[model samples]
Target: MNNKTTISSFFWQIIKPYKWWYLVMIPGPFVTAAFVFGYNYAIKLLLDVLTQDKILHYGDFVYPVGIFLGSHFMVDIFFRISNYAEWKSQPQVRKDIMCKVYDYVMGHSYNFFQNNLSGSIISKIKSINDGYYYLFESIKHNLTAKFLISLLCAICLLCINSKIFIMVGLFTVGLVIVSMTLYRKLGVMQGEISNDYHGVIGLIADNITNIANVSLFASKKAESQSIINHQENISTPLRNKWFKLNFITEIIVTMIYSLFGISVLLYSIYLKNSGQITIGDIAFTMSMTFLFQDNIFGLFIEVKKFVNTWSDFKTSFSIMQIPQEKIDKTDATELKVSGGEVIFENINFGYENNNKVFTNLNLKIKAGQKIGIVGSSGAGKSTLVALLLKHFKADNGNMIIDNQSIYDVTSDSLRSQISLIPQDIVLFHRSVGENIGYAKKEANQAEIENAAKMASIHDFIETLPEKYNTLVGERGVKLSGGQRQRIAIARAILKNAPILILDEATSALDSETEQQIQKSISDMLETNKATVIAIAHRLSTIKHLDRIVVMENGAIAEDGMFDELLAKENSKFKALWDRQVNGMVL
Candidate 1:
């Protein structure tokens, strides 16, 4: 579909829910039109009365003036009230849109996040909010106001002598031509330039978020130069766009002003000679012409503003329409994870047309089995767990849990049975209590403390003056690497899912701390009878696991008990185990 159709459809979907606001706001323009007619007619009345005598009569104008002034005041009040109403309605609209976007983002599988940066997504939402608010407010206020005023002014001009009315009409027509020309030639170019400026802002956001990395690489100069290049690209076209429109608008304004001046001056002279009209008529017509021209100019300005904001609004709306990963029905049943039996039968998958990451991968773990997955960096160890969790759909075979196909279950139900602890830990910028409590928001203080103590972090937490109340900076930056990792582990432990997947969960801790945390993990899971699937680079971490599966070049090369693999010299697991043993300093 075309952009306008897409934007309109999305916009209507949002606006439908706020139908009350739409009902109240739709009449705003008619109120404005009434005000224009009342005020303009009042001016005409005053001029007509003045012509009857050399001086104006206050008594003759008293009632008409009151009606005129009263209408003006009431219209102003209604305009303000309507504008306020529309403004207030904006947040509801924004909140609804943002809530939908939030649901969409959160419901997406892990791979979706891997493909998109967190900071960039945030920047996109911020930009969308700004442009959209302006977009709707401009349509409600400026567009309506301009249309009503233009229509009333046209009627006022036409009621005057037809010849002069025709001249004013032609002048408005010429201005429209100029406006359309400017819009056609320069509007699209300006829009592209504006987009480039926004993209530069996105780049700056990304760089600031990674400032530590930039400094570590000592690439400040290169980064600055790159920013400068983006700035220049934005600035150059913006200057040209403004220059083109300014030159055109200036010409239109000048021509209209001169033409009206000449028309009034010549008309006054002819009226004086013919005695058909007086100085009062001349003054009134001149005043009306200037008023009419002002509204005409305003109409063009509002049209220009509409074009600019519409383009921005369309871009934001298009982004909002991007399809998120599917969510299932509320009634979709949850999976039974008590058995903790995960089976991947001949599963094969790839991403973005790359070479297959998993080919005919088959595995089945009995209930309560502790399996260790060992693989090189790109050997698809993580991809295997990801498939079991249904992060990305498999191209072949079935991933079954408790004899039920994973795809048959809802995402929430499937994921509710699994707990994942990745190597890098991420925590929100909140108190330790809140971050840990995130896994289960309704968790009580005792539950929180017990989980922390089980993860062996309660002592460290208690050392702080505020204990669990201490604030962790953005992404838990204030915490040390090991500390953040423990918080992540604490979260997974608290979740108490039946199937635990640890992708190097203890990689950050020292050897001594790693051993302690591993023992705690074993004790805690045994007490709860939870099964664990772990991927570890350090073979020592998984020495106690029930089975060790070694992966090489995206396929499982060996699988058996750790001691059995160690005894077999030709097994790939033995080779990796030997390398780790040889690398350690005795």
Candidate 2:
């Protein structure tokens, strides 16, 4: 992005209505400067009056001392109040920015989520929050303070001698130009280094999640070496950038200080020799010159920080600009799902590769019927369900529910009427009750218990020390494979959608548990009046299903009743059944 656009967008994104704190902070510099100027003037007066005529002048000393002390006290008070306001505004701004970012990410389509890592998204949001807070604090507190001090120094310098004032101002401006030129170069390096760091985080998260597989393959040492390599890659560039900026800033500041100090000393000597100014005037001028130099130094540091923050602000704003899926219009009609009839007419789609997974594939599922789908890996079973949920738009198709095109209805309304349990069951680190309640958030304890009973898991839950309150640990790792599958089933049961889909749902359970769970499910379907779609690998699991459809290479391989298919030799269904039966030693 160009500098102007990046800066404008960054400010618009991070600065919100609460930025009134910045306006409140504007006058702090003037107030502080006024007090400092008053104190300095009093010092000049005290020095001139006390030394002149060697007189007692008790009143003169007393009045000037009070003015100086009182002005110093007021400066301190203004500093404290301004600092308080600046810090107070930080947390609110952080919260507002984080909330907006959260909304943006959550609103994105599932495809966006598939392309990004959860840990990276979380890290980006956190990094942006900290960056914004620092940026605001630096501008509202430190920026204003330094700018005010610089102005005070400029006024003091002019009051002392206009020649020295203009010269110092010119030199300071030169130093700033040089520093900023160098800062811009380092800013690019910093941005690159930050991107590399994010890559490291993504890598570590991926590795840690797959640590079991890594250990199984004996690649632990190789993984550690890879991480070390990435760490060094990120650190080396950052160190080089920082060291270069540090070295350059130090040189410029030193040069400016040296030149200014020499000029002040020589000017004071020349004026004193020519009898143009008194020793007291020279002394006060020198003190004020040093004071102004200190302020100028502070200003330089603030400028460097401003440059770095500008870079980070640009990066964070760009991330927020990535396109997200558009939500349906506010007035879109709600889709009414009943009897679970699904009709697909002339459907066509592919994942960015343009190789269609389904092309003009028409199918109809009647209400109250159990449809069994069997397919090899990559046969588009999961893809079909994902499209049914409208996770992405079909290249061209009409997916109708209750005879209405799903696209015409609100997405949430369509999804709410269908319960899907995928092959991989992901359980949150929460209580069993809490996890199950995700399907029906308002469900009371009795409703939760009822759902568990329907899924054949209520007995197992009651055996735990805390029953429904038992913590499942991360991804429900504390539970056995069969137990976790049952909990997922309970969640789906609680949803109680008119249409239910179980994608390889029984793949993890033993035969006894599977049979019992299936029996419970059949009974519950009858009791609740729900339709079911089961995707299975064992083939035998669907012998009781109403209709079985076999898929091969993204197309239907065969479709027939279990008994009729068993009577035909070399048929896809019979071959699958024979393989499964022979594999079971019993």
Candidate 3:
């Protein structure tokens, strides 16, 4: 997460912090393999003592018994020592990885979140953490210990008989070649499955998020069938590729083991007939063969797990490759808000694949001035606010605040000077006080209470069981539209920035409450000489504003005071005002 690492190198980059612990862990596997050899030798010694033609001595029994108990005790001690470091490091590393990945996701542009599913992003982050768990386990139980066991067992066999060791070595090579080839294919298949898995998570999230709509439309069965279809699509490939390949690999491994067992037994018996090795040597070889074979089986299972983990990790890591949409210029400076005079010069903008919404559009609002913008839907009202907030850069134009081009200033600094009350206000699932205080983190209770009073929501809030401490629920679902809008207003009022923009700020309130809020907003603005740009669909909400600008399509059609615009026959504002007065549908 800290370094610029490729997917393949990220594991080691994270592991580097705990290098000393891993170094200490290396000897644990060696001791485990050594224990296997020691225990096999004990078995051989015990068999030799029991089968001896001459009377067995008590000393021989003592030697075998001591070897068995000592090997077990030694391995247990070595395991506990190595495992302590491993347990200390792996879980912490996973927690760090999840936190870093989540932080990286947070830094992504707004468009990225809109384009991707939240659930899918969460799933990917989980995969990265789980993959690390698999990697550490594989290193411990699969690769190091198993390889050492195989090597040590081969050496033991070599000491017993060169011919048997040669056969075991060749079998090891063949089995590895076969496993590697199949594992490579499995890796590719697993990558495909990982993608499908992410998609399913996203689809399920989408369905659940819109559960209200599904219930309203009474499409329960339809939605269930949709999920079933997706499951079927995923399961077919999973069964065909994932399950089938694993079964084939298992079958091949089983066949190889059977053949090796038969060959070793026949060779050992022929050697016994020729008096080349004792019964104890044969016992040692057979016992070692079973031990080594079990480890190989475990190794293959872990290797498959590792391959799937690597595939998931690669899929999840690809997210970091997406370039962040908004990046501050290296030479950008902070925005110093001496006065909040805003100017839009020769602006050109349009949504992708849509006709131009603004061409050479221009507007200017002086400091300490309050102006209302009135327009029908698709009249570039919200787009103007978006450009002001730097949500989307215009195709061509310069937006200047206090004579500083917004692009020349750092985005964070630029936005800090302007407070916007958006049309669709989404509140966090938290206490109302926390949501209001979000605009100003250091704001105390007195300041938060004052802002809520100014927004005209304090009285209603007092009626709740928890008052300001009441949970808002997800996206403020527990609140009415009017309540949510007032919450947004409170947040903006608390911000108290030099520049303020309100888009449909009072649309959800009733006419009486709207007028009260209009007065409250005016009183609040009068104390602070800040610039205000208000966009309104309900024209009366902004009728008391100092000036009105009427928009048609992508350009301004009329500009004047509210009464002045109404007096003119050709004015767009007058037409809109007339329509509203007549209670006409807009």
Candidate 4:
């Protein structure tokens, strides 16, 4: 949704929908500045009246006192209005940003997830939340109100006495120029720090995910040292560079504020001695100088914070700049599975760096066909499944389902018709029932139990303390490899999609369990009249299928019925069958 090229543009566009809330907030800063300046003006009048009694009207007492107190009341009233507006606007803006970021990030192709760390991506998302919070607050309070207050005081001094104005104005400009220049350099440094922090998080996440491996190898010390080395050699040095530059900026800023204050006081004494200005004017001038300095200090603090926030905001949210890898046609329609026939026509595809997996390949599966695909490593077996599922688009070809081009339909609709039970199944940390019910979001308990029964996992689940309600733990670590495989099978049966893909699905199960599950799956698909694609390294898994296709070197080397292919002399299927049979005997 973020077609905007610049971050500022994106920020403003997000805020634009709530423009009315912003309008109510904008006036608060201006009103606050006027009250502060008017309060100082009133104080001057009160001093003048008190010092020279009867020279000005004695009745001026009430007017000066009233103006001074009235300004305070205005300040209080305007603050409430601003606070209410902020309450309405801030959270909504953040909510919209988070939702937009999630939807857009999820649209990234399957490879995006495979290539990046889960923790690093999570950290960047959090950065957007904090960065925008700081940036927005700084703009409202410091950049707008405090800024107006500084300018008003400067002009007030110029109107009454030119000398004080020149001294304060020069110092203000010098500090601003120095700050802006330093911030540009500091912002880049902060971006580097952010990168280091993300890397550390990703490293920790990677280690945690491989905890089993580390414990098995007894390499905890090595892993700990690796993390320490990364933090000391990289993270610490970048942060230290930021701290040093911050100290230098602070030193320069202190010098300017100190010099400006000293000059103002010295000039005020000169004016009083020459009888050029009254005691009342001295009080007003000193008061204005102090107020102006405070506002400048406020401005400096905000700018420093803004620099750091900008660094985080841009670096983290830059993922928006990446165009989605897959998109549907503008007129894309929902996919309809009429008999579920799939045709791959003149398909050419490759992964990164022109690593060709398939070239001008073609295949066809009739409606409700039980097809078995067997191949060795890098023989385009899995790639074929990935392409058919539309996880990656073909380089030059059309994939049609039920006479409709997959490219011409929405991905969600296309994928809805297919159920995939991947080899390495990763389950959410939820109840056993919830994991199985994932296939159908609204599935009842009865349906889930039935699916589990079909997959032969229901009996095992019943022995657990909470039965189907038992927690799976992180990535289903609570369960054995065989148990996890059974859970995956249960989901596919529950989904009962028009098309089913089983990629080494029963590999973890024992010989008897695998055979039983395979029989159950064949019966289920045959009952539903669904098209099934089974890819397996185990030849026994596909021996019962109607037809077997043997793939080699990215092409179909042989295709026939199980026994028909074995009967052929020097057939590809016959050689594979003999090798597996011989290996089993050994």
Candidate 5:
């Protein structure tokens, strides 16, 4: 869409809901403009009376002064009403727009988050809110008010002399043309500058988030220099271009308006001296001319603001326009998982087209079965879990849980039936108990403690003075890797879903801790009778599972019990087992 249409539609959407408040505001500028016209007329009457040859009376003085004061009083009252209406509406408008933007961003698929920087996303959201708010405010207070007053002044001047009206009109038009050309150029520069700012923010966020890596590598100076270079490369030239254009535009506008004011004053004097108009007419013409010039100049400033705000609005709208990666089918149903039997039927999938990761792969797990998936790094191990979670749609075939095709169910409902304990655990910056309770928002203290105890992290938590209330810093950075893993396990246990997937769940723990946590997990699985799928690099971690599946390339190469697979010397599972055992021996 064109910029004008986009901005208009955006404001309409935000303001549509608050129609009543805007209605109250609509008459404010008109009333104020009328008062300005009336006040100038009152001044003209006083000037006529003063210049008349007849003896002046106190009554003549009282009439025009009273008219002027009355007009001023009405202007003051209407202006307050307008300001009040704006004050009432702006906060609500800002809140509603921000909430809509936030909801839209939250609904984007996992892939969007993975590909975009968190800091840039945040900056865009803030810019959208601030831009829209200020844009609307400027429209109300500056653009609308000034336009009305300028029109009223022009009409008043036209009554005095058509030539003067023509002069003022031409000057206003020239000023607008110049401003628009400058604004178009400035908008482009501003958009580029905004992108540079986003880049710098993203850079800082990335470095701070990975501060541990930076410190370990002792690259702080390098990172700082990189940030400085980015700023210099992106910001310096844009700012210089912006200032040069802006300065020239201002100088031109000032000169044009100043000359227009002088020409009008000189013309009004000539008309009076020629006996073609009275002194009262000259007073009216000059006053209207100055008012018109001021309002017209203010209009240029508002136009600049609109252009800049439009740039920000376009950036925000670009994010809102992103197509959702995953969408629910119209006929999708809420998944009702029972026993959690999972089947991958003739699946063909890949991250990119022409590079298949799983080609016509099929697998079935009976209800309540414990299966282990083993493969080297790119065997589509995590991809399988991702497919089951519906993070990505398969290229062909279906994933069925409890006889229901996953694609036929709502994602929220499908995901509600499963729990995952990922290898890299990241907890919210909240209380320890709160993080664990996130699995079930309504879970009570007893349930939280029970899950923590089951995950074998209860004792460590209890040792802290705050116990369950102890805060975990960002991404659980205050805790050790083992501690964070246990917290994740606890969260999964609390979720109590029908299907559980352990994606290298115990990889972070020491051997002793790993064994202890494994026993806890085993006990939970047995007690809950949940279907389990464990993916592991450490073969011993899942060797005790009821069944083992070895993957080679994009397809399954071996599937059998742990001992059964190990007995086949030529099997992929046996090869992986020998490699791990021999590496330990070395």
Candidate 6:
């Protein structure tokens, strides 16, 4: 959408849900304007009463004083009520918008996340949240109240003298023109400033997340200098420019207000001295002019803030507007896994147009078959699993599980039937039990303990002071790589899906631990009659599988029983096995 459309829709989306609160708040600005107008009139009445030489009774003096006090009290009450209404509405509005934005971010496709920075997305979320309130405050309070007050002041001045009215009108026009011009300029600068700020945040987050790597590589000094350079060379300079512009705008606005106030005051005094108007008229004119001057200053500040916030709003909505790349079909159904049989037929897949990973590939596995896949780094090992799990849509293919096409099934259901133990295990900063139970959120402590035991990590967990309750730290940094891998295995065990995938699952474990876990996995598969697919670089990890498939450039180079492949000296599997055996001997 265009900027104008996006801005309008964003505002409406935030406020439309809580229509009642906004409806109540609609009159707040008008009431405030009325109070300002009434309070000035009250002052005029009081001045008139005090200046009158012929005070026949004390009631005249008391009446004007009482009116002034009463109006003051009423205005104060109205202000309080208006503030209370705003306080009640704003928190809920902010919370709802924040939640909605979070939901949108979470729903984004995997590719979207791969291309964006987590810290930058976080910055956008916060910016949108603050921007919404800023814009709302500007429109609901400053814009409405100031406009009404200015109009009332202009009318009052016209009644007193057309010359005064004409002067105020021209000043208003000039103020608006200047404010608009400044607002546009500031918005462009603010957008640049915001981008630089996001970059700084992103850099900090990236450095912190990889702090271990930096420390291991002894690059802390370099990283720190990089951050400092970003701050000094980009963020700091842009911020200075933004603030300077704002300061200049404020100075100009204040000067205009001062000039307007001076002109009105002189005109009012001249008219009073000529006996063309009373002291009351002079008092009223000066009071209104001073009030408007304050309002105009506040209005300009709000306008500037609104402009800056508009930039933030646009940045946030740009992310939200990204269409989901993977969406379920209208007639998608929940996948039913009867035998866990999987087949890939006539598959053509690629990351880019010129780089096809798999072209016209075909593969099939029978129910409860333990198949091992071995391939080079980019030979489509992980990509094969990803396609079966529907992480990415195939360029042209049919991936069928139990005679049901995966594309015709809901992604959640299609994935629920399969459990993957990824090579690079990433654990949340949570307790051991919590991480284990992630596969099944409703799993009880007993189930968690059982899964851990099966994965052969139960003994290690018992050694820690907090045991199952210990915090894993960010990405499971508190634990060893082997421990993290075991935790992931425990999670997959708890999942207990019909189809299981082991992508270098034992890569981090020591030889003894690997053997124990492999035995446990083998037993589990036998007991459950599960279909298994293991992708590994180490031939030892998959040498005992029921069937072995060696891939070369995304095509099946060799497919046979492990013994048969080993017997063939010319086979790719035999070549990989020879390399590993020779390396170990050396």
Best by lDDT: 5
What tens digits encode model 1's per-residue C-alpha lDDT throughout 19-39? 777777777777877776677
Provide the RMSD of all predictions against the true structure, rounded to 1 decimal. 2.9, 3.0, 2.8, 2.4, 2.5, 2.3
Q: Is candidate 2 or candidate 5 better by TM-score?
A: 5
Candidate with the larger lDDT of 2 and 5 = 5
* Whole-structure CA lDDT of model 3: 0.84
Per-residue alpha-carbon lDDT of candidate 3 for residues 1-586, written as tens digits (9 for 90 to 100): 3235576566666778888888878889998898888888998999888887897778879988898899899899988988898888877778777877777778776567878998788888888787777777788877889878977888888888899989888887888898889988888888888888888898888878777788999998998898889788774667487888878988998888778778888888899999998889888988887677777767776787788888888888777666677645779999999889999999999877767999999899898789999899999999898887877788898999989999899888988998887767889999999999999999999999999998889999999889999999888878987788778878888999999888887776777766776777776777667898999988877766888988889998888898898899978888888898899522
Which tens-of-lDDT digit does each residue in 156-252 have in candidate 4? Answer: 8998799788888788889989988987889999989988788788889888988889999998999999999988999889989999999999888
Q: How many residue pairs clash in each candidate?
A: 0, 0, 0, 0, 0, 0
Which 10-residue span in candidate 1 carries the lowest summed lDDT? 1-10
RMSD of 2: 3.0
Candidate 1 clashing pairs? none
Cα lDDT tens digits, model 2, 125-211, are: 777777777876776657767777677777777877787788778877887787778777767766666666666777788777777
Candidate 6: residue 122 lDDT (0-100): 87
Query: Which residue runs of candidate 2 sit more than 4 Å off their true CA positions?
Result: 1-16, 19-21, 76-89, 327-331, 510-513
Tell me the spans in candidate 3 whose CA falls farther than 4 Å from its real position.
Answer: 1-5, 49-70, 234-240, 508-523
Model 3: weakest 10-residue lDDT segment is 1-10
| Reference-based lDDT, each prediction | 0.76, 0.77, 0.84, 0.86, 0.86, 0.83
Query: What is the alpha-carbon lDDT of model 2 when measured against the actual structure?
Result: 0.77
TM-score of each: 0.91, 0.91, 0.91, 0.94, 0.94, 0.94
TM-score pick, better of 4 and 6? 6
